[model samples]
Target: MPTGRALEDARSMLLETGRRILAAEGTGGLTSRSVTDRAGVAKGVLHRHFADFDAYLAALVTDDAARIRSIEPRSAGSTVDAVTDVVEQVFTPTTRALVALVISRDEVRRRVRSPGSYGIPLLMDATAVVMDVLAAGREVGWIRRDADVAALALALIGSAHLLYAGELGAFPDHSATHEVVESILVGSL
Candidate 1:
């Protein structure tokens, strides 16, 4: 039973709770009731904020996309290290579940799909960030000047998604993540 402002701001709470459910049990465990129950709010609070469950999911995807775009690549090491850091940030269990959810639900996909944008919501943004990092690498003489950054970005992000999405227990360690990134960039860098 949240009061006025708390009720108004319950959207973030609901979204965070949904993210937790998604990370803990995957998309199959996330529902309006689960979100409300986890947030300690009434179910009506969710509906009051979002038009429906799909709408709520769309908002979650959009919020996550913005978050993905805001991640600054680590500048402490090689471009490989920086890209690896970005990939690790992007491929969390929650994001993987959101990707699965976007793929599974047509309405949620349509709602979150940006006009003229391509690929899955969170992954698309992740690719863009990786591309930015690669582009910066090119400018700094790390990546090859002739490298096709868009294709490289797509390959890196897609391959990392495959590696992370299939994991049922512990996520791949940082060394594994670094290896994947290095393998991909070995020729291009």
Candidate 2:
């Protein structure tokens, strides 16, 4: 058996290798053989650390989501701008690939939606940010008092997720998605 520290290092290397493959080639590029080959580890190493490929994928998504969630809201800016900035960051090619992977896999999706789940619950965080923006906007009379913030926020996130994930290869570009989200939230460019 590998020493504890050695095992940890190997796991880290495997994750980093998986991330590089996912970023460059999307989910299709990730597999036990490919990851172990790239990481120069035994074929069983990934399985030893994670029960299966879906588990590994969930771990990767969790890492990515945590990074997204850790971004502190900008101290100075329109709430719309703050939200837009986050949306732009979250819709990068890397993020899109991860989202697409998660959405397409039933087991992974189940893992993501479970309470205390591994993946980062990105939609929830996005919704929270939108709600915060809506509250601030309401305080400043920027948003109408009667706007259904929760519904609008959910709609924005859901639509953007689908667009960014490119489930059907017909989705709008990130810039267009950003514009649509901003327009929906603030009612103008």
Q: Which candidate ranks first by lDDT, i.e. highest? A: 1
What TM-score fits each model?
0.93, 0.76
Per-residue CA lDDT of model 1 for 23-109, tens digit only, reads 899888999999998999888899989999999999988888888999987653788999999999888788888999999999999
Judge candidate 2 at residue 119 and give its lDDT.
33
- The CA lDDT at 127 in model 2 is 65
Backbone steric clashes in candidate 2, count: 0
Summing lDDT over every window of 10 consecutive residues in candidate 1, give the lowest-scoring window: 2-11
**In TM-score terms, which candidate is top?**
1
In candidate 1, stretches whose alpha carbon ends up further than 4 angstroms from where it belongs are 1-8
lDDT scores of the candidates, listed in order: 0.89, 0.71
Q: Write the per-residue lDDT of candidate 2 for residues 1-189, one digit (tens) a residue.
A: 854334557777888898888777777888889999888778888898898988988888778777766654563266566666666666656667777777788787787675774433666666666667667767777668888887877777776776666643344655786576777776521
The positional error of residue 6 in candidate 1, measured at the CA in angstroms, is: 5.9
